[model samples]
Target: MRRIKKTQIAEMLLEHQLITKEQLETAIAQQKTSDKKIGQILVDLGYVEENKFLELLARQLEIPFVDLKSYTLQPDLVKLLPEFYARHFRAIVLKREGDAYLIGMADPQNLLAYDEFERILKAKINTALIREDDLLTILDAMYRRSEEISHFAESLSAELKPSDIDIFSGTQDFSSDDMPVVNLLRSIFEDAVQINASDIHIEPGEKVLRIRLRVDGVLQEQIVEEKAITQALVQRVKLMSGLNIAEKRLPQDGRFSIKVKDKFLDVRVSTMPIQYGESVVMRLLDQSADILRLNQIGMPKEIFEYYSQLLTASYGLLLIVGPTGSGKTTTLYASLNELNKAEDKIITVEDPVEYRLPRINQVQVHSQIGLTFANVLRSVLRQDPDIIMIGELRDQETMEIALRSAMTGHLVLATLHTNDTISSMTRLLDMGAEGYLVASVLRAVIAQRLVRRICMKCITDATLSPPEITWLKSLKHNEYLNVNYKHGTGCTYCHRTGYLGRIGVYELLPMVPELADALRQQDSNKFQLLAEKQPLYRPLVLAGMDLATRGITTVQEIIRMSGEI
Candidate 1:
């Protein structure tokens, strides 16, 4: 038997805190009986936590304990680490392009090493296993020089400009000159997928071209350049959507698909000719956004619980009312996800299906084919759907059909363009939907708005001025409670805007017997009065005020959007 060093024994005892001499002796005795590692013996003898042992081992070995699960390794960084470290640590460098590196390592079974690595790196590492072939493919895909990849992206973008896009679409009829345009169109579609845009909008102005992308329900400007490039980009988009390039005078619609990031996204493109040039809107259908859970949406508990109950109901028209860009689609999509199951048949009629939901049949409303909202709703009824989701109820025909579907037993979830729940009813009445029908068939109406959240890192306590304090005090009858406004201190985390992300301020109109009776009698005044009296009925202004009171959002946001509390 080899003699263990006294210093090594002391260190182990000190580190493991096998503080008792008897426990250390027991561990030593156990190590002799078990072929298991000495560290295992100490751990089994109630010595130290597994992580602590691993941390010690990492310090002894002078190597990183990698947990690949939480951390993302850029491709360039992988190339910077020594190859010996990669091989010894059993890591495969997936991508080592230019200055970026993406590395994948085996599970960090050595807890000590992982702790040390975490302390040193200050970033979490995510771990996952990959096949050798897949790893090799990733490595091969890495560009030697980042500039090459960047330039290729730039060139593809250049070719996608409005003028070039126009030329390409114009020449797609198989003329020898049309080859460049065909190639250019293919390249732009490929690039659009890489950037993860939900929709692409190409609007032509008098002297400028604007390309906007709808990402996560908000429109973001992707590119703004000269008109020629914008036209080319539009033409390229039209060609991919399978529209006639020369038919720019009339509105055209088309769709195409591209594989990106190991997933397929459907892109729907719409173009209308404006005075300057053709305007285009491309809607990207990324399924991931639709798969979000209800809790992930960040609504307050009251609103979330209220909506949850409304959705579980068997039948009723649950209308999500909001202005454009208020995340109504996301809320509707989340509700559909909640209702979707193996047993139920869910059908949706979207002007164009924006996102694909698995296990649900989505019908696209084609105005050209006379497959408008009314036609689709009529057709969806025959499909035996348990739930029907109309994208938007623009006119009387669609509104009536949707209401009939809900009244007859189908759960209808849809969006309407309005400022609040009350306004939605008025708008529906103005659109030719009978007032009584609107009252009876309506289950609940949710009106929502987005307000920026105070950046946690830069949030500060601020004393409110007399006017602000007076307004806040007016919110409740109890003027005795002390309250102060929270404002952002401005930091890099919040882009110096003092806000990091947006939270939803929701107003839910819960359907009660009294409210339903008022709607049935076409009594708008009674309905409003009842709504105000309900404890759960939170108007948009009150919701905004609640958010401001909690310091989750600022008073100014509430004032600007929903008016003073």
Candidate 2:
């Protein structure tokens, strides 16, 4: 496969006179603009039927042609690799022979896949040329093993005591029933991780304990057993996360790790004392979530290119502003990836080091031991780091250290809690940093919020409501008036919510001389005007609206995200 001459498809077509030279030239040109292979491009352009092209290519390459339309595939066989790896390599194990695997691949000519399959499956790979559509069809089936929750949700059938499972009742102890509780907690963790849920909430109510999972950004209610059982489950979770199971009267925080498949996720558990009982919430921090590049965040092309330019600056503080859970951490990591170099030293100090990046020294802040953000920033500066990332510009001391680092030489990246990019400058000033200091070293401010994306599987054409139509007329999108939006009515894939995943709606502001002058002079009114008039500036409201017009999200989400433009 490494020595495969992919030109065999073109040569075969020429030998059969299946396409004219002009048609071949046209198809090749199209291929340059697309990611499809030459055979797929030729078939797509109607130069040859897909089946015939695949068959001819198969014969030319001396590989078995697999028409999955009529082929039966076993889910267990295809699931030999994790869903992430399966989709990344676009190859799945069809069958195993001794130490070799018969792998289904769209293009049997790929040699890079051989090494990947060997590394993942720990075996050799034999090629079977499968239709691209067929390969994707079975990937969904293979991934269903993880995403389908009905399999492990049966753990809710256990019975329990009704009196809230008293921790200090003196006579009651959970040691005897620890095994069943452990199994139940493991089952709940498995179901949550499989569906890629961001957080799991188990709350105690007067009559029952409500268990819910926050998938994407929406919380989905789940069927629960009696209140008595949930009380036991709460104590079980506290025990697993190393919290004080004997103290339900006060709030607590703890963390634990769980392994699902070949990956491990850190679950941050917190319990808040409530009216009926202690309510538990678990936030899953998957390491793989932070490794995404910027384009995956769904930034508009203009905004993406603009932000990419800002990351190239050698010495300045670039801040992404948003509320907690609004994708600021992900944006910060993406920016760090842009600057990550082998020769240049990069160091980050975070309260809780979430994702471990390669070639970067990461420090976790322990405020309990006086190892705060300011303390760590001062120490990281002494390390002679070329670039530094402070997790948050939390207070005046941390801001002072970060600004000095940026003004001296290092490229600093951090996040702050603010509503907009312009507000970020004001926030820095409010944090007790000198106006001149902030104006001199600040590079760019990016404000963002997460909006759930419409599920592609269930999306259907949508008509504007009367209020929605009236609202659209007031926006700056006259050219987009004819645009048609879409929404998911409801589907199981999205847990009955119209949206499946989250994308960021952003507003970015680059520091210009005039804005710096305004900030330096402490003229808040002038600074506001200068910020609003910056060249090519798009506000968060407009960006979210553009996404709505293009059927990416709904208008309701826009109003909910940015509030009436």
Candidate 3:
């Protein structure tokens, strides 16, 4: 393969109009003071897309462009290059042909890197271009945490005492000392954050203590063999969360903030007394991340416009319904972010305020002290609030207050635990809400579910089986059968699971006069029929199928998310 200088690459990009002359000059100026190369500076300054720039460079240099995320290296070959040298050179072994080794590099122009690799391997070398991001991601995955975690576990097992004495007692304070128990806990948390896991489970068995992380809505077990350190690990977590470390007979809950490397997270800790011991579950919430805007929440263009109209309405009740962990809170927060303005006064009453919004008054529900959602909402009404957000409609009193407030000219946005959009109406009515009042104030209902997205790095075309195609035809979804579909084949970037992240599938139901009349009449059959007739009323199953056809997800994900064929 041929190599080009940095100036030649920049000039080529400019000649193709990939970036403007002004952008090239700005990048050149920054390259003088920074250690990053001109191409790296241009990409960092958002002058061009990373993949596009890399593809252009590959074409210019006449070398293959390797996507390291999809490419897997043999364990033996990976051992040939030490991790220190590999990371320092930003390179990896791609393949071996006869006596020559093909290496993937982010910066193929680095002669020093080539010299160092040749000296270490003592073999003929070939070079290809790879994306910087892809190289870094593959590096982290190749060098996993199994070795470090096992080392921590071994150290803790050796240091632990047989007696049930609390090593982290007397004040819940932290020290800079290198305690094995503390190091084990820190590794667990850091791994969870690195994988974007939502929850961590620590369960003690009769012979072993198991650690599991919930990633992409599925639990993956970790490698921890030492059961002797269970108590010490539990005590350390309890101290950090401010829970009673001595009490193990009942359930308790607490929260704490942790900094894993540079990322800050808020972890909600809950403990329950199991037969073996106390089982702990921690829910990790990102505290340092910015709030997602409405447009960024993955809503379809038409639905987003419709939802925006509902938000702008002066007075009505808009309900977002879903099961637990269905991204209800995220959608609500995104909606609130769009409506957060100086002209409107917004107040939210939550059981435990999750994220703190600026310039918005938030209240936490304390039912033990008689300060419940109903009480807080009533107080909010008297304060003349323009918008009120209730975390969840738990009881009849809260639902009644929310209905009255919506009828009295205040835009009310709240969440409910229901399986679908149409069911939310009956859930409210079953909670003792009057039918006529509900029909008068209800504006719209949004039902949502989170489904795993296909890993783009390893995506390939997929064909549905006979049974799968028959099921889709039965549901009147014929358009999907002839379309080109895709799925991930599993790779290191996705933990060899064929999926990397999640996207929301949604269905919206707007309250028209015809449907409202059926709702007021308490006619379930007529209401169901009318709901099916509404243009905006698509079932969650069909919505998910749309995503599947578009290659954003897979057929299995649509079925798994809907729990139906």
Better model by lDDT: candidate 1 vs candidate 3: 3
Kindly give the stretch of ten consecutive residues in candidate 3 with the minimal lDDT sum.
165-174
How far is 274's C-alpha from truth in model 3 (Å)? 1.9
Off by over 4 Å in 2: 1-164, 167-176, 288-290, 476-481
lDDT (Cα atoms) of all candidates against the true structure: 0.66, 0.78, 0.85
Residue-level lDDT tens digits of model 2 in 1-565: 4334557668779888877788889988988889877777778889888887777677777778876544545555776777777777777677877879888788666677778788888877788877777667667644653333323323332434445354323223577755655665666676677667889998878776677878877786754435556556777778778887778778998888878666688888999988877889999888655587887777778878988887777799989898888899888888778778888999999978888899999999998799999998888989999889988989999999999999999889998988888878888888798999988999888899999888786678877788877777787578656777888765446544668788899898888999999999988889989899987577998888888878889887886786622
Candidate 3 per-residue lDDT, tens place, 270-338, comes to: 998887778999999888889999999899887899999899998999999999989999999999998
Top TM-score: which candidate number? 3
TM-score of 2: 0.71
User: What is the Å distance of residue 164 in model 3 from its true position?
Assistant: 3.6
lDDT value, residue 476 of candidate 3? 78
Give the backbone clash total of model 2: 0
| TM-scores of all predicted structures | 0.61, 0.71, 0.77
Per the 3 Å backbone cut-off, how many clashing residue pairs does candidate 1 have? 39
